[model samples]
Target: MNIKYSLIKKEEDIDILQGKESTFANLHYKYNKETIQFLKTHFYRQDSLYLVATDENNAFVALCSLDSDWWEPHHFFLREIFIMPSYQGQGIGKVLFEKCIDHANQFQAKAIVTETAFENIPMQKLCEKMGFTRWDNPQWKEGITYKLFL
Candidate 1:
């Protein structure tokens, strides 16, 4: 399937990129008013970046959210990465991830970091494949931090 990727530039873009149904229900959050508000607050921040991948029909297939790390100006924290169920195994996630890496590089970020729940084996594997090393004693319980140096 033909796919297009781009940075989310406006609130309307978020509405288009996120649908009512989600493949990541296990993550336990929806694009509701509160979430949308949160996104709106940070979406255009100078230190934040949000990207989306869409199919030919303009439906969202994947998304990635990132922000500058508070403790390290050269580091970026990957806040979210999700791929629709039907798009899994099609390398859409990898493409979205590569976009994040490229964005980091363009901003002169030295590293990218993210955390995933222990039960999310697929995400763990993806991070590993993307060359992210697991950090020890992550502050978030039941999850591990992954870091990829640029």
Candidate 2:
């Protein structure tokens, strides 16, 4: 698989959010034109990283986004990440994850954090495999939260 990473442009991002395979269905709100405009305004400010994995045919096989904020000037909150269903189990997710980790290192973040639904076993397994420790707590949102010190 010859997957290449490219930044998500305005039009492409809108198309993605509206695609049939969108993952945003889990969220309460929908990504519409207004939201797309808002995202464009501050997307780069939050250090948003959107990478599309395209095959040799030049078609997008998968896509992932990493958005983080400097909560403590040295800590990062990894807000989102997702890979398209068609390319789910081909190691593309892992590669994209590594790229995000590498960028996090460059930013000098003391720690990286992410949250996943309790029912999302596959993501939990992947996080564990990538060295993320489950930070279990009674008050934590009813699902597993993983953190890694980079």
Candidate 3:
């Protein structure tokens, strides 16, 4: 599949975004308008939100967001990373992840952090595979948080 990358700018991309949200149950929202408004506002900044991959038809297949100012003014946070069901298990997540890592490096970020709830084992495993170690605890009973030096 051809993977196209572009900045999500128009309102129509919201529908494609909502459709892709099914892969991430944490993103389930009762009202899409509110969800759109929230994400559009908080994630529009450059280097924060990015559509890193698209399919042969130019439809988005994988995407992610990085919040650079969360922990401190200089640290970049990998807030949200999602790949469509059709694109999962095809190394799309890794590509998107590496892209975010490059973004962190470019920003001169000291560290990159990401969090996932207790139930998301897939994410936890992926984090471990990506060389991220647990912080604040070992069991991760509260939640899974990962940091990588940038």
Per residue, candidate 2 scores C-alpha lDDT tens digits across 62-92 of 6555566544456555555556667777888
- Separately for all candidates shown, the number of backbone clashes (residues 3 or more apart, or on different chains) is 0, 0, 0
Model 3: per-residue Cα lDDT over 35-77, one tens digit each: 6566556465666755556777776676676766474567777
Provide the lDDT at 127 for model 2. 86
lDDT of 1 by residue, 1-150 (tens): 898988787756666434444444366434666665565666766868888888899877877788884465699888877777788888887887888898889999999988888767788888999999997743556788888999
Order of the predicted models by lDDT, top scorer first: 1, 3, 2
Q: How accurate is candidate 3 locally (lDDT)?
A: 0.69
Model 1 misplacement above 4 A: 17-29
How high is the CA lDDT of each candidate model?
Answer: 0.77, 0.67, 0.69
Highest TM-score: give the candidate number.
Answer: 1
> Alpha-carbon error at 24 in model 1, in Å?
7.3
- Judged by lDDT, which candidate is best? 1
Clash pairs, model 2 backbone? none
TM-score of each: 0.84, 0.75, 0.79
Worst 10 residues of 1 by lDDT: 16-25
